[model samples]
Target: MMKEIEFTLNGTRTRTETQPGERLLDLLRERLGLTGTKEGCGIGSCGACTVILDGKAVNACLVPAQAVDGRELVTIEGIMQNESLHPIQDALIRHHAIQCGFCTPGLVMSAKALLDENPDPSRGEIQRAIAGNLCRCTGYEQVIEAIQDAAKGGKTQC
Candidate 1:
């Protein structure tokens, strides 16, 4: 059965009719047309479907659409403000953190979630924050460096 769900998506309040068993990833991409959130392993092992849900990073593919009825979600599309990229995005560009760009969105969301809660996280903490995410290209060094640079105001690390 399809039910109406209301939630904050990408900083905007949205309402959509979703089936009972539909994954949040489907809802975000198919229903809302937010393709920035990718689906790699669909079973939640690959963090390609990561998103920030109410201040926590979670695998969108693992969450039921019904579960997001009243929560706040931040996707890659929502990371920009006033036509400007988020600090995380800027850092990624500055440090060449992206190679294939398939996992960039998820990685960025996860890093943003981490920095949102703890602006000055240690290298270990940053790694832990993005442990769930899988990056086929860039080998994670650049991603880690980009995130660290963002947290330290572009100085490369804290």
Candidate 2:
């Protein structure tokens, strides 16, 4: 049976109908029309379906839509404010951390989760935070540098 779930998404109240076993990723991308969260490896290895759930970074593909009921969920599209870019997005640009950009949204969301909790995270902490995200381009050095630079108040990298 389909169930109706309500939650806060990108700072807005939203409700959707989901099957008993529908993943959050499917609801976000297919039903809710939030395509920024991509599905790279549906098994949750690639971190492409990463999203912030109750202030924690989680793999959307692994979370059932019903699990998010009454919770605060943040996606890549929700990170922006008043047309201004989120710090992580700015940092990625300033650092040139993106190449093909397929993993950009997930990477940015992961960084956001880290920065939101600890604005000035250590390098090791930052590394641990994003360890799940896999970037096929830019070698991750630039991505790490970008995140670090952001912690140090540097401007956008790309």
* Residue pairs with backbone atoms closer than 3 Å in model 1 (clashes): none
Q: What is the TM-score of each candidate against the true structure?
A: 0.95, 0.95
Candidate 2, residues 1-158: lDDT per residue as tens digits?
89988999999999889897789999999898999999999998999889999999999999988999999999999988689988777888877888889889999889989988998998899999999999887778888998988777765424
Clashing residue pairs, candidate 2?
Answer: 93-157, 93-158, 94-156, 94-157, 94-158, 95-157, 95-158
User: What lDDT is reached at residue 93 by model 1?
Assistant: 91
The residue ranges of model 1 lying beyond 4 angstroms of the native Cα positions read 155-158
RMSD of each: 1.8, 1.3
> What tens digits encode model 1's per-residue C-alpha lDDT throughout 40-98?
99988879989989989999999999999999988888989689999999999988889
Show model 2 residue runs off by greater than 4 Å.
Answer: 156-158
